[model samples]
Target: MPAFLESERLVLRPVTASDLDDLVALDADPEVMRYLNGGRPTTRESVRRRVLPRLLHEYPCLGTPGFWAAEPRGGGTFLGWFELRPLDDDSPAEVELGYRLNRASWNRGYATEGARALLRKAFTELGVERVTANTMAVNARSRRVLEKAGLLFVRSFTEEWPDRIDGSEHGDVEYALSRGEWLRRHGG
Candidate 1:
């Protein structure tokens, strides 16, 4: 499939059924799942039944799948996935941005690159007014990526987690960027 977006080092394409194995393997790394589920590996059955379907669903607002598999520009490997999904299925005015990468892809700037590219698309082409993201307050790495992608820290709040993870006690932090704010920052 053609790319949904691209950055200097990554290509974002709509996720497909063929990506199941890669998704399973990405979720298998305990370190990768630490903040998400306290190092619990997501079972293939779970990925197949629940995760893949969510990733594959096309959002009417965007007229495309909300999740995109991340790979190298030349199509090397599945580094992970990125999401720019509408907060409401029928509206593109506000969206949630997120990413998950294999441990090998971490600390290499792929996350920031892909995120900035998505932000650009959201504001300039997708008619998105605001983009928001949340991560565990203790996830410094993810927080840094959000900042680098131009999202400002909005607040810290707690929510019920079905199964609490290691840093759940610290709550979660929300970061966001309004289209107006983005344009000011980018001199648009």
Candidate 2:
């Protein structure tokens, strides 16, 4: 079956070949890429040749896994993307959550909405034991989203960035929540 999940205001569908244009446009926005690649826009060639292939190859063999192209419900606008998958191929029980939204969608609770929905699914139906998210130390926006999604502050660590962006000097922070924690938070 095709991969998909729906929230009240978002429909997260698998990233497919046809989503190439939307992916490119999302990456082209410097505002959206500010935290990811230092505001550098991804070339269309890269999307066509590399990125799309990687996303297409990752459509979970079973459940709706990997990255999803998130759009507003009952619409065609590409708000952004969200991911809820393992840190690596071998770590099935430990998942990581992440999102990248267009500037237009910012401050509208779309990010938190998608994240909460993903977390609920992970703990309830996806066999996920732990969920983690990391972002630049100075990224208050993303930090807030993670917190609102019920992930607690885990730790801060420094890592070398190949292309070290403007805020890379401050290191990164990780936030996480386990299945037990989720259950307790939701009174399950």
Candidate 3:
């Protein structure tokens, strides 16, 4: 397994072909998918054929950067996954940071902890100029995670959705933090 990073309470590692079941289970939870896919569950086959292959392929072409499965440090139980995908336009030092955790891990600061670690890696190791995250405008929980990680709200904008949820009309919010901003927040 290619380990990308480690935080105080979590381990961030690359996704392997064997991680399909864990990924499927995480995506199967309705609450986890509420804002992402209108609470629609993803099929195992879709993950096997589409998602896993794409993630694996991305690592090589993108300089070993892609999705990392988050596991508890001591026991290494799969909690969820974090993504640090490079922009398709090939912009250097510009990547999106995102996470999805099991419902069991909600409100426990796992997301914030993992995100902060990833942000640090992006700015310091990957030479990332900026890091961005986005979630449903009504997802206060996710927004709080972004804020706790030192990312500020950049905008709230509406986009067409194939499967609209009750709050889809409220649009989505984008949060961002530059490398300089992160440094200032850390007083380094």
Q: Pick the candidate with the highest TM-score.
A: 1
lDDT of 1 by residue, 3-111 (tens): 8998899999989999999999999999999998999999999999999999998989889888999999986699999999999999999999999999889999999
lDDT of each: 0.95, 0.86, 0.85
The runs of at least 3 residues in candidate 2 whose Cα sits more than 4 Å from the true structure, single-residue gaps closed, are: 1-3, 59-62
TM-score of each: 0.98, 0.93, 0.94
The Cα error of candidate 2 at residue 49, in Å, is 2.5
Off by over 4 Å in 1: none
- Of candidate 3, the 10-residue stretch with the lowest lDDT total is 57-66
Candidate 2 residue-wise lDDT, 1-188, digit = tens: 24378999999888878888888998899988998889999999998998777666552422455788888887878888898877666655888899988889999999999999999988888788999999999999999999999999999999988898988899999999999999998998
Kindly list the per-residue Cα lDDT of model 3 for residues 1-188, writing each as its tens digit: 65789989899988888899998998899999988988888999998988888667554334775678889887778898898887653554677889999998888899999999989888887777888889999999999999998899999999987777978889999999999988887885
For model 1, the run of ten residues with the poorest summed lDDT: 71-80
Could you list the CA RMSD of all candidates, in the order they appear?
0.7, 1.8, 1.6
Model 3 TM-score, 2 decimals: 0.94
